[model samples]
Target: MSESTPFRAAAAGRPVAISIRNVSQRFGDAGSPNEVVAVDDMSLDVRRGEFVCLLGPSGCGKSTLLNIVGGLFPATDGVVMVGDKPVKGPLPRDISFVFQESTLFPWYTIRENFDVAFKFQNVAKSEWASRTKQALEAVNMGAFIDHYPNQLSVGMRQRVNLARGIALGTDIILMDEPFAALDEQTRMVLGEDLSELLAKTGKTIVFVTHSLAEAVFLSDRIFVMTARPGRIKSIIEVDEPHPRSPDFMLTPKFSELRNQAYALLRDEVRQAIALAREAEAAHA
Candidate 1:
């Protein structure tokens, strides 16, 4: 697609939320044997209010692509545009990140954690309370507002972590394996809740996950990546509408799509492992 192509044509009336044009990321200087080209010449367009998932094997640079989109790291080549503006640095007011590890302050209460995040975003003190409350309620974490991070379960902590991201009130949210640490049951529940929340809020979300099922269940489209140096192998459209139900999980369509993604990734994953082993052998 051309640079002028809309990120999400369906949501064109809304806005072009994120545009990644031929972006690449390399971790070392030229001529270095140890240099790793993490991401290679990938382009994607994410529209406002759309949910896109980056699905790839470990070391396939899914996170690298997300970091470039979030402006957490600069791309070695190509450009990232958020809402038509080039992303040069961390756009705190426009982007919020939910990492794999809970970023909540263990020392502070949940309410306090939100307060500090809002403070960092320079949201007015007067608006903090209401925004914090509203966000917590949206994630169903409102009742635990006064609880400290250590007192919460892994699932609960993630709820608070998600709330903190939402409380930032940013247009785009980038999540990197945010539910990977939770048990399968917890992850399922959280995934359902997240789907519902996305449907209601219409927030543009770009999530990175290894779960084939999660990608099929939650994303409008899933970007299946190749092994490192990572490239876009294929993009799978889920076709299922959001606010998806557990019943959807048991259907043939879901299983069929999941299998398709696995088939596309199996060889790449094996190749990635073989490459790692070769590198290790050379080092030894």
Candidate 2:
């Protein structure tokens, strides 16, 4: 999506919980013929309890940026700070991640999968049951706690995945298109659930999504990005408080914002295509 002007949230006065400065990511060696730069020098701050969406054209390194912030991988340049500390590796206590695919092991029951995650995070054995119960209940998946991952539909499996991430009790969550695979109706329902959950828990979330409507629905502010070697193209503000309803989508304001984001993205997608063709010609 596109915006002509960048609007940084002015003086809401919330403390910055995560500070990302001039972050860039590259694969392979510098200047090598095969080298690919996925992220340019992009920087932004995510405040406590805010939900920020990264929206951009395909291959724009949205997931790459998420991994860097989560410390699942290192950046080629710049730095990410969680609170006052620099992110060097997975910060399990402060950050958690949810992926597009179901991360639950097929053999494990829904309850058991959560137990495994809790064990890895080294939560006390006593807290696992209570935490697991609470998280499942929040997503309305409590009844299926005994079901195996494969037994559930894709939507249900994803719901369990979301519950597991929230159950981890991290103050910050980095999600890489967690709802991308779902059908529109399922995604909308889950988006509603997420908004409500965010209101209750007040965790900071950096969500990556390709859906313009989804971005508008769930984010406090959307970070529209450039093409490959992605950087912030513009930041679009929703100006709505969380626990947003489906009714919001039917409003005039929502349509305007959706069109605006789509307009911004259209040119970037064309540019990305042209660049791809040039690279192909060079290699050919």
Write down the worst ten-residue block by lDDT for model 1: 1-10
For each candidate in turn, give its C-alpha RMSD to the true structure in angstroms.
2.2, 2.6
Clash counts for all predictions: 0, 2
The list of candidate 2 runs beyond 4 A from truth reads 1-11, 279-284
lDDT of 2 by residue, 1-284 (tens): 22223444431357888888989999989999878889999888888888999999888889999999999989999999999999999998899899999899999899999999988877889899999999999878999999999999999899899999999998998899999889999899999999998888888999999899999999888899999889998888888887899999999999999999999999998888888898899989
Candidate 2: residue pairs that collide: 1-261, 2-264
Error of 2 at 169 (Å): 0.8
The estimated TM-scores of all candidates read 0.94, 0.94
Best model per TM-score? 2
